[model samples]
Target: MSQPAAATNAFLVATQRALDYAGFAPPSPGATCVLVFDSTLWNTHIASVHGLLNAVEQARAMRFRFERDREPYAVGHAVWRIVLAACLNVPISAVPLVSTASGQPHLPGTRWVTSLSHSGSWVAIAVGEADCIGVDIERSPSQMNLSALMPRFCTPAECVQLSGLPTPLRETRLLALWTRKEALLKAFGTGLNEDPASMAAAENTIVAAPASCGRTAVCHVRDLDLPASLVGALAVPAGAMSHRLYWLDRCSNDVYGCNSAETSIRSN
Candidate 1:
């Protein structure tokens, strides 16, 4: 009989290809992590969740918050906590999963900050000691009404640039543009309420913050080299410094890079 799939194999073989594009490197003085989850692995991990969290507070929070939820979401929540613990070299239970008034997550007293994104069978989390970070990923939007959606979010220039693309390329580019805009909004704690058209940032456009905050906040964004089936973007404050990437399940280092189905596991 044929052997079963690798217990930790990614759902898409193409995802492996995407990682090559991600540009993984080792951690520096300020740590950064990219936690990728396999759909096939989540089911197995959930049953083993019995002792994942390590602190009384974290344990209590999981019991009331994460455990009560259903699969994938719950599993993803657990993974988020796990990523925090893994990066900090602390017990999963010792990591305090708290959010600010704007709903961005933080480690409370620690130097690490984070952003999460999930699409189809994949979940990705980027953590660093930068002022803030936001990451997003999505499946190719072949099913969406892109023509209808572009104007709502794409600035005129962005629209024209997208329009000039071949039919297939346009959709991916637009979705990627939207993904970067979403990442920036998440970084700024505005979510989608802020107009994406004005906020859009492309590979060439790093985007400027609003008139508020003296516009001193710098947004640095870039496209990830992911599979054609997916698109993604990473947004961090300009002074974030260097970053590294890792695979969560193996705790192994990862290097490179996609857009739209944004963070399925993140509540805010």
Candidate 2:
């Protein structure tokens, strides 16, 4: 495994320790859990990685009451294993794996959801059995072509609004809007091919409807107050969503969970 990012290594170690202390080993009698992780950080050792995969497969096999080869599902399953191993107290190898029709990862038979995104050197994921959830991370590079993509991915109004801003602010706003729409699409279970510009973020929610899995969907946008280095957005069900934003500087074991009361937004 590549060394975890300087900002996240310590947090991963502490999380590992907590799981170990909780007796969260693989092969629980029978239970289901959500696993989340940054795909870029996991190191895959054949023996160790497989061990965690086995644990999750065993759990899934038990859930389905069958015996079959779960190994095929374990090969590209690194991130799934790490998150399950930590959050669910199981061996990373033991997390069950499933995918949506559009190829988005998911935990089957329940509302438990997980999504992944990678930007530059960083990766992020979110796992929960919430009503709906999506998380995305992007590397803020100095040379992103805002003008070139604005027309393609942004609405006419948004493009005009973005163009009106000072160069520096316009660049930041373009990226923020892009990430928000992308997160909304991921949550809606549709990738970029879904034409995200149809959706617009207004007053903390996305207003345009995007097509996903052959159905049109909308999302509530909640801007997360992370460090200036990071611009994060979350999408969940409108009106009833509970958005808990956090800045997890893992290398320092510092997780800043936002405590502000839940805010409501309407996408319609």
lDDT of 2 by residue, 41-69 (tens): 23322223344445545465336332122
Global CA lDDT computed for model 2: 0.52
Task: After the best TM-score superposition of candidate 2, give how far the Cα of residue 121 lies from its true spot, in angstroms.
Answer: 2.5
Among the numbered candidates, top lDDT falls to 1
TM-score of each: 0.71, 0.64
RMSD (Å) per prediction? 9.1, 9.9
Top-TM-score candidate index: 1
Residue 93 CA displacement from its true place in model 2, Å = 3.6
> Residue 189 in model 1: shift from native, Å?
1.9
